[model samples]
Target: MIERLISLWPARTGAAPIVPERSVAGRTLLLLITIMSFLSAVTLGGVVLMQKSAIAWSADVGREVTIQLRPVEGEVMDSNLRSAVSLAESTPGVASARALSIEESQKLLEPWLGSGLDLTAIEIPRLVVVQLSDPAEADIEGLQRNLGAVKGASLDTHAAWRQQLNTMAGTIVFSGLMVLVLIGAATVLAIIFATRGAMATNREIVDVLHYIGASNRFIAGEFQGRFLSIGLQGGLLGAVMALVFFALIGTAAGSMLPSEAGAQVGVLFGRFALGWSGLFGILAVVPVIAALTAITSRTTVRRFLSETS
Candidate 1:
């Protein structure tokens, strides 16, 4: 019965490999699975990275708050800055408080306005950064009121922005999961189509085998093995391709960004250097894909045989 598929490609496989080595349709199916796996892997990796970035962003935000001393003609800007820094430092739950120097503030603006900008011509508020021991334990409302008592002072922790970022990250992860589910479904359908087509192509041999007392499982096993091998090959190819894509993106970003900016970006997005665990996670896709392919093929073949008999 196995000899029937042996002639699937006379030029490629004479008898050694009987399943799907040389079948044009089989190769096309494999290619389709490979592309689908690639898309799935990329999205899966993106979700994983985004999750990590969200954690980092949350930690960074959760640890700090900023006190802005808006410029006012009636209030002494320097005195207000000093008073705000001292109040934050003396306050309970506050870890440290420091104001950015004029040069440092100018450096922050350099990215947008470039260097050599006039500092005295325009009024720029002093930025006093406040770190908390534990954001959860900190008395944020009390601290805000205390800071507001100082002239021209306002407090901002960027909670709104952080919440928005977290929402965006969750949306991306949910979207990625949906895409993976669709891809998996498409893969199963493709496997079913390929299995049924194989059965139809070798219907004569299969029918003969059935009459001679062959069980459905025995008939399905051959197709399962072939499809499993194809699935494994495609899965590995996809993982490798995804890794390469990420590595290239990392390299390009490193080259284009300044050292300080690159470091900041790494803190936000990770170094893009997925360690051994991440590699193992991606490589794990191989066995999973193979199992899905094998099961889908086996089930489809058995159903088809049962209906025909």
Candidate 2:
């Protein structure tokens, strides 16, 4: 099976001996895997960082809840609004609460409702924005009961939204972790397969070396050196390709998102520069994978030769 794959690329194997028979297709495949692995790591790490940012943003502003009040069929709207504000101020777990001014409410709603819409002409429900000393310290049900006592006032908090956001963050974190695991697995698999094939192809060379009294360690070292070189080459090529791909993606994404989000994406991309940990990881893992390949190949080849002899 391996021989057939090598044979498919006749030019690769039939090259002049002086030129050295580097498996171009094999190396290219390794390069592809390397690039994909690195890109996956960088992308997944970015996702984790983005999720952290989103969580912090939510935690910072999640404490506030708005209660809306308006006139019932017979009640006065202004009286109901004032009563709701008073109830909010008196409520426990409430740090500060106030009725939003007409202008303030208009400003908040302006994004969804265009400027042309006359907010004052329509009978809009009066809103009281409440801030809590501790987001979770408030007994929301108790607060709701108190607010319900006020005429035409309804208590509302982002409890459901917060729960959904938490779920999303968890999902993002899990997805990022999965991506890293897959990248590691792919790198290992690629190295294993490439080394196995290279070993099988060079079986005659290895046998001759064994006949000439080359120790197993020496024979392994030669293969190890070749595999290591392949790994290093593949890794460097992959890093470059990943960088270029990231640049293109960043440009495209930046154009689509608003300035703030676009800036965040830029920041994420900038952080993709190979940090010390990343550098150490690639260098260490690639060489270790190569060495593993060499050892596995040598052992398998020795067993095969012995059995055949």
Best by TM-score: 1
Worst 10 residues of 1 by lDDT: 9-18
lDDT of 1 by residue, 145-247 (tens): 8886897899998898799878988898899889889999999999989888988887876776666566778878887888888999888888888888888
> Model 1: clashing residue pairs?
none
| Candidate 1 TM-score to native | 0.83
Listed in order, each prediction's TM-score against the native is 0.83, 0.65
| Model 2 alpha-carbon miss at residue 246, Å | 7.9
Model 2 per-residue lDDT tens digits across residues 1-309: 333443353454544321124667466655655675466545544664557555665675587888988657788877777777777777778888888887887877888887767777777777988888887667667778877767778877877877887887788878877876777667666655665566667666666556656655555555555555665565555555555665566567667778887777655444334445444544454444445444554565444546545
Whole-model lDDT for model 2 versus the true structure? 0.63
**lDDT computed for candidate 1:** 0.82
